[model samples]
Target: MREVFWQLVRFGITGGLATLLYAIVYWPIATYAQKTWPLANSATWPVAANLLGYLAAMLSGYVMHSKWSFRGHGRRDNLARTGGRFFLVSLVSLGMNTFFVWLLTGPMHGPTWWPLVPIVFFTPLITFGLNRLWVFA
Candidate 1:
């Protein structure tokens, strides 16, 4: 319904903001660490960078989602429940992202169009439902 649409819009906005934050803050750090550390190989570097970026975004997103996206939802008032639910959602999202990135890089041979394609495509659909019905409700 209308509420669902609004929720989706809100999630989209929140996701955009979180992605911006991740790209702005995490990208340089990831790239620098990758070059400076010399621990991971070229193939492993993207995955490691992505993991760091995802973690940073998730931390920022949890706060933004609680305060902005799901503000009216009383579930966010309960810090533990809200945080736990967010964590659960994030875990699923992380798994999905990892799988997609692995498939793209490993099997698909690195299209390099947008490394965040999986997140951009999948997270909104799945997370919006979870946030509305489970976390926010």
Candidate 2:
């Protein structure tokens, strides 16, 4: 129980850092793309920026989770297998984030920042579950 609690705490800290990084990369890029692009659909450019932000977060998140967050909680016998599973989990997160962005910005006609609600609150929970049960375990 204590270990799980500590793991969750560490995960939260690391995840928060990664989320900050994502926002730093995402907001500016989305703003710039929207300003520069001359597309009919405004959501398209922001979606691309979202992908770039996810990639940045995914890389740092994996390293932090593996090295600090999930340390001593799972096997480390095979880097290739662990990395592949981590990447898969990240893809799941990416899909969720992308869907939220699309739903908010495309059909709903919300601002780019609107997607951050789900991205910050919802997506982390799902990714944490997958990381704890499958990716790290």
lDDT of 2 by residue, 50-118 (tens): 999999999999999999999999899999999999999999999999998889988998988999999
Colliding residue pairs in candidate 2? none
Candidate 1 per-residue C-alpha lDDT over 53-94 given as tens digits, one digit per residue, 9 for 90 to 100: 678889988988887787666554577887888889888777
The local lDDT score (0 to 100) that residue 122 gets in candidate 1 is 67
Candidate 2 deviant stretches above 4 angstroms: 39-41
Estimate every model's Cα lDDT from 0 to 1.
0.72, 0.91
The residue-level lDDT of candidate 1 at 42 comes to 52
Q: What's the distance in Å from true for residue 5, model 2?
A: 0.8
Candidate 1 clashes between residue pairs 3 or more apart in a chain or in different chains = none
Residue 62 C-alpha lDDT in model 1? 90
Best by lDDT: 2
Q: Assess every candidate by TM-score.
A: 0.82, 0.95
Q: In candidate 1, how many clashes are counted?
A: 0
